[model samples]
Target: GRPYRSHLRPACDACRRRKSRCTTTESSDACLMCQVHGSQCVFVDSDQSRRRKVPTPHGRASSYTESGGSNVDHDDTSISMAYSGETHTHNALSDGQSHHHGPAVLVDPGRPHASAITGSTEEASMSAMLAESGDSNTHIISPAIVDDNEELDSYLSSNPAVGIRRITRTSSTSTNIGPSSRRVLFNTVLKKPLGIHARQSLAASKLEVIEKLLEPHGTVLIDLHTSFRRTYSEHKDRLSPALLSNLYANAMTYWNNSPQLRSCHPPDHRFIWVQANEALHSELFLSPGISTVISIILNVHGRPSTSMFGNGGMVGTAVALSNSLGLNRDCSAWDISPGEKALRSRIWSIVVLMDRWTSLAYGTPLLIHRAQYDVPVPSKEQLAQPNASIAQYAGLSIFLAMLTLTDVLSHYLENVYCISRTSPIDRPPTSSFHLETLLTDWEDSLEDDIRRLVIRGNDLDRAGSGNLRLSYLAVKLLLRRILCDTTNATTENEGAVQARLQTQRVAEEIVLLVQELSHSHLRGFWMPSNGFTLTSATLFLLRDALKTTNRTRNTSLKLAKDMMSSLQTHRVNDSWDLADDCLSNCTDMTDRIEAGRTFESPGMIESQYFIDNNSLMFNDPVLGFASAFDFDLENFQWNETT
Candidate 1:
């Protein structure tokens, strides 16, 4: 008789176990119940051999094939043959035979748990179990183990039941150093952020670690800045894009954020925690806290909010704040709230420096007004008025201030690299590539810093001194210095001389004010981290010597050049050779450079070399006028006829 047919059918695994029809589609690989539960699919065959029929011990069981072998075996006989064990289990269940392995349904109880299985077969088992679990089970199974080859393996142990399931789950959605050697190294010592305190502690620890990492780089940055400034001053066009970019990037980071200018961090012993969104903590693992903090400053200071404030006008707030604090009136630094006062002040100083940098770089009225010198334009009174929102603009203003920091840094490198050949303290020569290099690099850095400020204004206005802006500005300040011309303009006309002197005086005033601001507010002392003050002081001294009336413009210029040349040409083994050149060159070149001149004495170079390498050119014209005079030519010709 024909059996009653129901509209619904059993699940794939159940059908495979029962050796009956499974209505599930191939794509789903499971019946409706299994599909609802994310299960595996299986089909069955009618053939007696595919049914896992127990054979009669004495002979072939003829009745098992009573349905007819050729007619019962469906085209998909392979599928049923694959699940023959399930068929056997189903047969036993239908026969009411109790099985021992575990809770027995239609599927085989002896089959290993899906969790205990592995490979593709395990996947299949898991799918089958999922199917059998019915439609109600919706818990996402977290694979509790990770791949042995992955970095997570060091921290996450292997799981027998879950195999690498845990690892698979974790790897699905994660943003950090990859699960490789770096991850392993990180996991060895660090723990994941579990709560607020734990995360903050981790963040603080990472910051400290980053600070240490950046210490040596800070020194390198100082040296590079000095070298770049000197080189750029003399050889502006000779600079390379890559080198410029590298120097600029580094300088921008320092100018905007230094340890002295950044936020105060709690000690490692104190409880700490970081929010998950702040994934940047891991980046500090490699960079160090100081570097990271500086990076944040550069980012902030390099881009100020253009919405609330006009272009570089953001610096007005910093100046106002500095003035209010009764610090250096030049807006070198400012103190705000207790927690972030130091960092805020540092950022303000950077902003001021950046404003100058932009003036030099873009050469725009917003920054640079006239061809000869930049006009010190103050902002409108309304903008200087402080409010909570204004504080945010303070952050934005810092970013806008150093947009060209990178370029300035490059210029600084150019100068440093060129003058580095001379004694450290020697006055830089006009034709020695130092002047052009400094101008070009500083100009380029200022341009870029300003552009970034314009673009990042919104971000700065919202988050005062966010990592992005802070990093940008810090790099700029890390690479700043003043370049003074040793050749002062000399004029016999009283009006002309007074005019020149007045201009020089103004320039000197500006320079001195800058220095004073640097020393008092920015703490530009000769510490290992702040050794750039030496270079600044040397330039100021040169400016003073140039302003003197005892020497002609050309004579003092020649002296300055001779001093630098002697320092480079002679071998001096003194710690202060560079400083010595700055002093002796002023005296020697002013007195003598021509043969038979009163300042000349036999072997003057050798005599000075004995005193110090920088003083080797004490009275030698050849030191400064190598190109001016030609001893080899029988008929020497001066291009600029005297």
Candidate 2:
């Protein structure tokens, strides 16, 4: 009545005897699952060594059988020829129907009458043991041939089973940049106990590729870092290699469109990151000098990781290290040399900036508060002015602007947001006038060159200038929302309408600021902060669109759709994902509004359309309930289940 199920590939002996499943795929052996569970894997008969059946065009199935019974890990390199007399013949026995496109299961025929081996054993990088016969003819085993020169990602996608090959650990020091070699090194360091020296050697080998990739941009990456923290420039060579790896990784974020940069940045970023993680642990357990703290900070901003080792944990680690080093105290007046005092101040300022960022990002309380530390802002003397490159002045300007902006954020989060407030947690917010005064004072403090850039929102085209302008707009936007957040009686008043208009104006400014940011260097740097900025602005626009008519429909829809596409392109962090949620809600609102539907808002018919998607504002898998406006929205008190 039904088609026959091919029994060519059988379950392994361990799986059959124990009545469990063996995790074998097209290019791998049956030992993976057993090894994971610390059990021995065995195949009972010769037929069990074959792979599972795959579909053919004629509704028939085909199975590949290896010639020999040994479960050796297959070489992931593209080996083009079979040693049989016929160049295209293979060890596989397929159905009579011709299979046009499929994996070329290259195994030795093991037939006694097969022709003798012809290839010289030529060594390849990262354990790619390729057999090259020195002949000009490249044998075509099947019509569907995977190009030998394809990139690692493409080959791995089509050859999923190749990455699944078990990493056999040996004391061998050689490694390569191929997918299989990376897997081998990953398993060796994680599964097996690799010595520090062996690990160092492996880590050192990974650097060769990085050097070649970065050769075009000499010390641009390192120089940019030195400009930001002149202290780092002073002791640049003294910094450990592990910390340097992390610095390079962060620099890659600025040029994310590059395929090479994307493959090596952070958290789950391959090769380089593994070595960085080791250094972080070693420093954490020990004193964790300034270098380690800098590494952790770079990791925090490079990209957000959801694990405990992510931004939240890294912030805490950096904070603890700062406290231990007495960074919270005013090191400026310390009896130390000018260089040493400036170094401590600069480090503390950056640390405080990140502490606030992670707090907002994770919905946690602020880790650095004024009451806890008396550290003063870094003076220009702290920034390298004497031996400074021309780029140093621009970098130093941005660095100081960031420090002052951190003060503004700290005040808002402490006074307006309440999560970071030194006083009672649920205390009523202070007057918006006080926060505005603080902003005005900070604005006055800005140098002439920066003040000019900060005022004209459209001129914020540089990465530093763009981010700086966005940070300033954030406080202005928050203030407008708070002024407009009112009870039922105030909803229809002229004041409420004016507040919404002002807020809308701020959102429009943000939209202008982000028009060039979709795929630019500025977007890649400080990405999470940029994600939150875009989300807040989008939310405001979507709210305006939902309450208004069809005139603004196209702009809202296009912006949201474009944002969703951009965020999906990188899938960088939880913030991007949350921002996507905001875009999705905007699209849905536009559709519903265009269809002549009137919806009830949570508060006086102006609140967001919190529909069936209950996880809209909060409930991200990693940054749980840490919406773009977590503290601000927590005050809104919208009922999700409703």
Candidate 3:
């Protein structure tokens, strides 16, 4: 076809230069582009005599006429530009409607049109497109829509489009926001208002179990019962979501780790532990020192056997947080209340004690030094007050005694087992004697009530006292074993004999203690005892049974069997596997000794054979039993009197 042309009016200069179709009505003075650009309309000369096709004026003028002449211009190009702009605005409005669940009106009554051309053509074209597309929900911007300033403000305020833009802007810049800023934003936008009834329901259902589990240990470090009560009473005003989530995580961990619960329900500790672990990373509790410490404690307590090294590192983090909060400093000089000061002191003391105990357990270096913190210990008066809650009084005396015991252990570790200054060969024998004296003195200083609790208390009290006594016994056993090892490494026979005798005495003490506690008591005490004392005692019995030929051998073998049987009943971890293997090894050794005597080949029994066979038993360093006795003692001359 030949080039199409508008015979009614020639194209304007700007439209002709752009090769775009242009039309004008009797009402317009310029093309839409020329008018929009504020330029004069100069049309190109065309062959007016030729009859050219003139389409009907289906542009802005007709639409304005159709809309009852609503003061709109007759410019097709301007109407197209306005339509494109409103199309973009319409898409944005649609997105806002979907996201915010609101109406799809694109036009803001408060925002005026950016140009003089009315949007009547744009609205009519959009309506036609929506109708053709079968969309009945399309909202069009009306040219005559008007509102007062207050109404406009209210519309803008209630409009989802504005809120969407604000949200978009915030998310776009969220990377630059700090944790506290993000926390504030989350609290405002994401956190739902949880009611007290719901919180109490959670507390009564799950947190109560946690409080019970924690009550045994919360007397000194954390008063979970009191804290829970306070939180239940003042959660809306005082507790942060992070703290609440952290507490929930801890409760889940306690629930998961409870042996009673595990026996009833299938094992879900891994799932609950992971959930609790993720809550620790939340930004809300990142800066709060006490919550962080509580999280560490719960984590350590949850997996006592597997998390040794990890818990050591967490203890370092706790110490750093404690120091950052000035918890290491004496709070007495501060203007805080005496109760607050006492609580702070107790927390610091707990951190210090935890650092020492974990360091000793994992053979890691201590994080908190004794001289670094001057926080006072809790007074007896504070512990004995009648107003003390169950959580406050439950383990009060035990905790105080443990504080003193941990102090003694810390001193013993520094002086006798200080890795930096001493090696096994370099440590003097007198160091063990010195620590023994100190340990004895420390035990002597314990109150008579504590002694009575350990000797004759019922099941619950006996378990607690057994835990305390086991700790002291473990330290004493460690010292004696160290002395024995150091002395055995020497060529001096006299010192070796003395160290061996002392080790046997300590071992016998431990065996007696273990025998005194029932199987249920031992099972209850297993978690707190860490199996160190039990393992040591079992090793001693095995060694005595193998090395002796007198009637004491029968007693030693019987005791070893009983202890192993008790340990076999409870499966805390792989530690019990080593115990079982030791028991088997002892039974075999006793059988061989009896067989050799019966066959008149007692001299044929060789120490080298026993050493070669039993060396594999203690390959696990945690067992540490293979080196407790010299299986090659046949090489040394026996002294019957010694």
Candidate 4:
């Protein structure tokens, strides 16, 4: 008779285990068993079932075949097989079976088909196995138990199949796991078993330390202490382990850097840094708000090696987060409280300012385009409200002024430094003239008190005055760089001469400002200033000194030398040796002039030097004037007649 082939499909694991019939109306959807049990009805292929057949004592087993021809005997009655692809296979062997067949899954009669069981069944099986052994000490092999490789050999006797075949476990190597896995592993390994009270105490201690360290600068943009306390009290869930760790890391870094705390033993800053990074990347704390911004700022500012030009992605992330929160839009129409709205406005302003600064520093495109945001600048009265703290008022005032200053910078960047079909080389003279007019207007528009604060350094807070003045000088330098293009002989025209003269005056202003700042005890106030303004001033003075053989040349050389000395004293990260090399060259030229010899220009040698080192010159940290459309200073020739 012909063999009868059943037309009905085989039952799924659940149905088969329950000894119930399984039915599927469609091939793509769940079967009756899955629908009723609310479980996945996975059907094993006919070939797969056939492959699971028990092998004869001499016949090669499927396990052996699947394991790349490794010899494994499957005749042991204690051993069983399971069909789950996601789980590891366990084999148990009877004493009669050869141990030479790969590691055997040890089975207990109490745990019937334990290899094929899971959940409550597996738990019940383990309990029953313990009772059946009577001694209550019978060893039950489980997946968790199998994770220990050292205990593997003692559990099973030598079997060629088991000994030769490696047991795969989850990788301990951090590099192999995803960020989430690494974070989980880090939390598990580094977590301390401190009580809730202890954790709160530790957090309080850290917050105190951070506030003290950050006190000198004052909380300008975001009030870290206030935000943290508010969140900790009311929105505790919002503060994740990552955020706390990052906050601690930032505070610790500041503390460690503090001159007063240099003798104290700090925690492993690197570990805290990694933890903070993990927290930032974790899915638990992606909310865009003051906390996230503070975290970003701390991460960047805490790391001494962090460069303004580098870490564009981190800056971009912050910009994106700010945008997502609609920080770019005016929130007056919203029903939010006045204080909250004010905070948002200030943060948005800061984000925009930072975006522009980074753009200027790295020659990167601006993240916050002027057209995308309409948030009005906060008024001085609004920032100086009675509710605002003294520090807050001071910080916001300076921030507001700096924000306005950046507006001018942003325009300069868009108009002159922007890349387009009409390169800066092709920029019309009127365009540069209009930008200069804008700069002059911006300076003129400054409040009389603020102007006095900048020039006289009296009465008003000096927190942002230096930055505002330096920014003005930087913009002036940028405009002058454009107007004094040596490649265009037209620069020698009357208009060009006027531009050069203005540029010289701006350069002189920068040197004077630097000298003033250097002499003051509040020099640290200007430490936040990049190397751009000073670097540009130095180069300009050096170049002018080289072109002139008069007494003013000596004065220019002296100023240039003085500026370089101040930069060195400040330990400004030179990244490039432009300052040092420029000072050396200026000294040599000055000596020749002093010797009363006709100073011969280096000509192509100087041009090649400028050309080869153009990147270093434009990208100078102190001189944030370099933008995407930077002028080719290398093209400037030493005119025998200035």
Candidate 5:
């Protein structure tokens, strides 16, 4: 077999490096190594190449033809560098052109030109080889192409090569359109705008900012407090005295309507059905000072729109005096430091008013008629019930009035004892709402006030002497203690000490008042003249006082034993029962219907501000009756007198 030599074109450089076959087809780009690696396969430039000097349309020459050559320069093998700024021109040939080359111009390699080259051809042979190679690969892709297909000129405007050539002739009549359109196309793809996506992300970020502004404590506290203030002011002036009388019932309306705050209670007629001390969620009123201010406002102005007490004086007084003494802060009276002068005064002020109201409400008897006003009589069944009406709150009002008085008096006494211990005041004492001055002023007004309360209590007794006696007894004991003598005989250093001593003395006097009430003769059977009796309650009071008072343990014990003895004697005699039935019936009728519970044991008179309800018994002896025949001492059963 003869070797086929002259017709075999030079091998591509890429095929030599990979040790793979080279087709040796002239101007074809594909070689075995480029095909296997899937890399770009292109013609390599050498000294003998005719394609080495192709002109670049732009400023730089094409790397494909940068070197001008004719001889095979095999030894000048410096590694070829890629052109930094370069471009190349490719021919756009029309179909059926006849720039003839041997063997159908075998450029149809199906892949890009291989980089493999061995420079052995002369310059003339290289040109001939390119002609054959270019002719073989050229094809008429679409003969019926329209001129409008060059619309890519608008999209890739600077790259002229990207414009369609239309292939008018199939063979060698091709034009090399400029290469700028490819650059234009690349820039268009790389620098695309993204305005819409950015705007959406920004909008979402703004919404998050707004949500955060509404989340903190500053916003919620401001809104809620403002609402409460607005509500309070709007209704305040509109409340009338008559309306104020039922403020408790009215305040319940506000609590019911607000759903968030409403879960704290069941739907009920009363905002607080249980007693004040028993309220489960009263802490919802969170302000420490709000209750005190409300009390003061009610005390001076009749009632706050939100009050439960129709009249405000007593509640206000209690809050003001208690806050002043710091009693409201601590439930246990014993917790206060004995050395706290201000506290002692406030406490004693409460004690004074409590005592004064008791004396006026309970110590005096009710008159049946104004004509017989100075004279006392048992009020008819209609007039004696406790708290007959809001007007009767005046007895309770007197207790409230004493708050400031007791406060100042206790303070002055402390100071007076402190100063008087060494020397009498070089200056005369001045008056400034002190307890003594209050007592003096009250005394000036007392006759009228006492007359009024007595008339009112009588009016209540006339209504029904239900728990009136209990209220009366409490007020009497309270007032009697206040009237116990206080002296300036003590020196200045002893003023505070004396006030304390005086307070103890007052408590002792109160105990005495209770004992006296217990021993007071019962007009019918064992029904006391006071119209009600609570011998057990008196003992209870003594026991409670022992827990709170600073009195010696022995003294409290002795007093307690004495009260217990009295209770035992009274209960054992069987006479207390004679009055039990009548008292019990009166209590049931009065307590349920009474607007304000004022019934009390004589010992509670020292706390006139309370709405205390004491247990009671009526004066009907069913035990001795033996089927109703042996009783009825008033009517004399069977016309017989025991």
Candidate 6:
């Protein structure tokens, strides 16, 4: 049994974690301790993986290898996470294939590693953050992991060989914070975003010499902020990883910027984008600031060509950050400078845009609802102002147009799309005429830049214009669909008939718009977010096409199929498989000509973003344990399914 001395081979990660003796000889693959416990046999250089010295292929010092072999482990945190199935570990020296040891790291054996970050399933190698910290605030993870903070600390301290103790700190003066802020370790944020994972990876990649790569694409991403020079001048004080990583991710995705950036998405550039996200992931919790919120806004504003519909959590985080920073609240009356106030409004405007887009697409509730925020809309004078940030984000006209259109979308979602209502929803109101009036007025007010038709090459403003139009069309489409879905055939009126015909017409416009504006550039924008409505539109069209055998309705059905074909590009380009399901449903429904056609919900993607569908109608005993309340289900008629 080992005491405090460092072993030649060192202990495997799990064994070292518990400070147990590794009873394996030189010939055994796994030690007796690991084999008996049914754990993997892995080796790692110590000093918190960051300073672990690994020899190069030719037995030379790798440039990345830190000199210190006895540095203190600074990875201590109170919030420890526990994983399921098996103990998972990650190491920084992932690519170093060093079976042979170089410098020996002294083992304190009194403190256990608790900074568990990314856990992987690989048994042969390790990466960053393996062992879980035992922080009480760590919440229960779904399916597998949970934060068993106290239990883990007790287990580590219980070992006779490993006398692990919680690390703590104290301030010399009573100026900084109360006793509560000081812990085993505290985060001291620097002027610049220091110790960023992306910055480290970027340095490791040695991409500074690649100025050709940086200027063409990286510059374009910088311009996205309106004027990078102005943005830089304003913040010339320091750097932020959240902001930098967001730009990197934007260039790497097929969604944002110009075609030039997306087309030149080489393997190396894409790798930086991937690494950028890892950096952003670290920044997600490491710090919270304006740059972090902007990074999140950019992250959700456009997606990587290969990513889809998972930004719900990211959007929620942005909303929380926005509220915390007073982005949702009006800063106009504040004593801040005009530029700063304008910037806040712009950022808040986009946050609202992304929130509604995500909520609509995922069939979820609004994070920042209408009544929740008191921020005022911008005036014509503000829109007319020559601001770099405004221009960088498709000008103020486009923002205003989008802002108004999204207001209508939010109204629809808060009312028509809401599953729960104070009273039964009015399915077919005689009119969505007022909502239509607002939408039409917004479209009419679009300035020359966003209103201009796409004549030639990829005009960035045309994209803004096209996307704005698409948003308007989608709102109009959804409004019409409500009338169509709720109107019964037994009492079919002229308005209901017109609404049905209008549904097909809107689908045609959506498909045609996708064809015209180079849809990939828009990243499927409002079209896909209105997926449920799209499904509803397509199904109703198909029913009319077959039922009446009308050539116009048939043509509408054809357009719906063509639109699906365009969206299919997301499957190949964005790595989303959503089209296959909806497409198959359309095809299968078409094949079964004689199936009963009293249409129900779109049934495309039954997204449970935040609200539980079951909890809305029925109460569960587990959730309401010891409660006498029961839903009167005796009179509730469950729908008969085939």
Give one digit per residue, the lDDT tens place, for model 4 in 1-642. 332335466665445545566777865476775666444466767676557545434333234333322122222222211212111222211111122333434323344333345444432322221110110010112323333433453464434333222332222332232332111100000011111001122333344444354444322212223323333444333343444555566444233234444455555666656566655554112222334554564454343323454346767877775654445656553322344445567667766766676666565677777777778987866444445556555555555666677898887666545557756585434455676787778767777766665445444334445655666677767777766663145544677657666777777877766555532222222312234345556666655654444543466667766776654554453222223433443444434433432334435334534442454455343233452010001111111111
TM-score of 5: 0.21
Clash count for candidate 6 is 15
Q: Which residue runs of candidate 5 sit more than 4 Å off their true CA positions?
A: 1-438, 447-505, 512-642
| Tens-digit per-residue lDDT, 157-215, candidate 3 | 32222221111111122233333211111000101111100111221223334334444
TM-score, candidate 6, is 0.52
lDDT of 5 by residue, 601-620 (tens): 33343243233322221121
TM-score of 2: 0.54
User: How many angstroms is residue 412 displaced in model 2 relative to the true structure, after the best TM-score fit?
Assistant: 1.1
Top-TM-score structure, candidate number: 2
Per-candidate Cα lDDT values, in order, are 0.28, 0.46, 0.44, 0.46, 0.27, 0.44
Which residue ranges in model 2 land beyond 4 Å of their true spot? 1-238, 255-271, 303-309, 416-429, 461-463, 486-493, 516-527, 549-609, 612-615, 619-642
C-alpha RMSD values across all candidates: 28.8, 22.9, 25.0, 23.5, 43.1, 17.5
Pairwise lDDT winner, candidates 2 and 3: 2
Q: lDDT score, residue 333, model 3?
A: 37
lDDT of 1: 0.28
lDDT of 6 by residue, 1-642 (tens): 544535555666657656787666788887787666544466667555436445534221122112211111212211211111111111211111122322222223243332222122222221111111111111111212122222343443221112112311112221222232111121111111322212132312323323245655555555434333344443432445545555555534332334454455444545655555555565555444555566666555433323444467777887886765445655454322344445557667777877776665555677887776767776545434353343334434554666777787777666554555565564323355765665566556666555443211135432244545656666776666555655544345876777677767776766676555443444423223444333444454555545343322346546656666665665556553334434544555543332322232223112311132233112211111100000110111111111
> Candidate 6's C-alpha lDDT?
0.44
Residue 85 displacement in candidate 3 (angstroms) = 68
TM-score of each: 0.24, 0.54, 0.51, 0.52, 0.21, 0.52
Question: Of models 2 and 5, which has the larger lDDT?
Answer: 2
What's the true lDDT of residue 252 in model 2? 48
Runs of candidate 1 exceeding 4 Å displacement: 1-388, 399-510, 514-531, 534-610, 613-642
CA lDDT for candidate 4: 0.46
